[model samples]
Target: MNKPEAASIGLVKRARALAPLLAEEADEIERTRRLTPKVVSALIKNGLYKSLLPKNIGGFESPPMVFMEMLEEIAKADASTAWCVGQCSVVGMTAAYLDADVAHQVFGKPDDIAAWGAIAHAVQAVPGGYTITARWDFASGMRQANWLGAHVQVLEADGTTRMRPNGTPEIRTILFPASSATTHDMWNVIGLCGTGTDSYSVENLFIPDSHAALRDDFSALREKGPLYGITTYSMFGLGFGAVSLGVARATLDAAIDLARKKHSVGIAAMKDNSAVQGLIGRTEAKLRAARAYHFSTAANAWQEILNTGKLSEQGRAAIRLSATYTIHQSAEVVETAYHMAGATAVFKSNPFERRFRDMHTIAQQIQARDNHFEDVGKMILTNSVIPRGPTM
Candidate 1:
């Protein structure tokens, strides 16, 4: 194996080593509605924050699969931590598109970079840069992030929309200091609450040209690595899918432990119960199959980019398909395990309860929507071009 591959394996081992500590702090994280400073420090100290960054900038620049594996290990301990890590890592990858000096200024220090937010605002062109006035919601990890990014539609100096050749308004992601934006405490949800995915807004925030990156403009990319060829959307699908998988695995383990010890009024013991036995067997199969499919598709896509310097549409579609399927299947496994655990699963004191909630929330994410299956199917069936959207 190559040196990078070996290094990635070591990183994954390190992530696994942190699982016990992350699990120990999961309750406190949930109570705070954000990752505890200690948890964040552990991730930073372990070099997980730079999993997707370019090597030139003191990042590991590990392959997508290695990044996903590390995320899975973290998620197995705490889904919220995994979700936040995934956001930070993927956002860090954007550094490769930035100018060297700007990248250094924003991401030079591992603790200084944390870009997590959506972009649905308008940016007006100014002399040296753009003026942004808008609000972005679901800014995960915002509480700990020193920097944040928002996607915006570029407007002309006169306040008219700037159109590209395709007649679509030019869109770019603008980066700014997190302190410059006003954050709203609005992340109350059923699960993954520790992500602190609140809403934040900036009024007339001036972002210099150096702080903006053209949205998915591969031609403008400064890094020629294979990881950069994988679209951010695809990475989200894979990373989030891995998170779901980890949650499912944790849920299954919890249920099995419960089964071995508990005996309901009717059943002699959960272990000896025929129905429980069958459910366990089936759920394991489903989870393993989904995991294999996801990793295989991701690895194949990564290989294609490495060999050819570009990923084909079919490869992208396969990745979308596998990720979507894995997430949904993982949810099913968790649900089945929760059901088998009976009353124990419904209690907050049990591991099954939180994991059950987290698994469902993961499915609710845009990346896990079932529509991706239809989109991939249409592309494969009709052999026509599929318009890129959030899921793809």
Candidate 2:
């Protein structure tokens, strides 16, 4: 196998090796509403956070399939950890688009971590760079990051919004030291709380031009690797969909275990019941189907990039379809497993409750939204999606 292939296998092994520790720390993570320092340190030590970073930056830069598999393995132990890893790893992909000096400054160290949130505010243009007083929310894994990024619309010095050549508002992701911002405790949620997906704000912080990049723009690409050809957005979808599958697999397995050991007073043993058997069979089938489709889509997309050095519009649509469909299907499998566990599923001591909540939470994220189906369907129907060069 090639060096990349070998590196991919090694990373997945590392992730699997860390699973038991994640499972052990799961409760503490939930209680603290963030990953325990032990878990964070372990992940850092393993270099799992740099899974999607460019190889030139001392990262593994593993294939999309390997990325998904590693996240899935971690998710089987702790979905929040998987979510945080998935988010931060994809954020690292931005390094490929940035200037080499700036990229190294931001993500150079072994333990360096960077986190960012959705686009919300605009940064004011200046001669050297941009100045921004803005707050960004939903920054997952922010607690441990030493660097932070903000995706913002560009406001020109003359009080006009900068526009891309395509006529859309110009957006740039500005990277700054995490110490420059005020971190907030805003990640209170029903599930995936261990991610520490908090909010933060910076007041008139000046970011040099070198510290920013037009994310996912073809023209802005600085690192020309086949892995960089895939869009960050699609990588997020693929990774999170894998997380859902892991959660579903674990939940279903727990349900199966409960069925084997628990028996009601009146009804027959759950494992012996024909109905329970059928449900287990069907749920397993569905979970496997979803996983298969998810991996196949990712593999096909990666293969396309390798063959043609670009991802086609059809490939992008296929990715969206597979990710959304797998997320929804995994949720169904989790629901079925939770229901099968009966009273046991409701108890916090059992695995079902948390996994159930986590599964639903994954289902509700932007990656799993039902509208993705409509979007991809529209694209497929039109056949007018101009095949762009490798771009988001």
Could you tell me every candidate's TM-score relative to the true structure?
Answer: 0.95, 0.96
Across 1-392, the per-residue lDDT of candidate 2 in tens digits comes to 88976886688889999989998999999999999999999999999998888888889889999999999999999999999999999999989988898888889888999999888888889998999898989999998899999888899989899999999998888899999999989888998979898999998799999987997886789988889888888899899999998999899989899889988899899989999999999889899888988898888899899998778778887888889999999999999998888887899998999998988888888998889878876886787462322433
For model 1, the superposed segments whose C-alpha errors exceed 4 Å read 384-392
How many clashing pairs does model 1 include? 1
Among these predictions, the greatest lDDT belongs to: 2
| TM-score for candidate 1, residues paired by index | 0.95
Stretches > 4 Å off in candidate 2: 384-392
Clashing pairs in 2: none
TM-score for candidate 2: 0.96
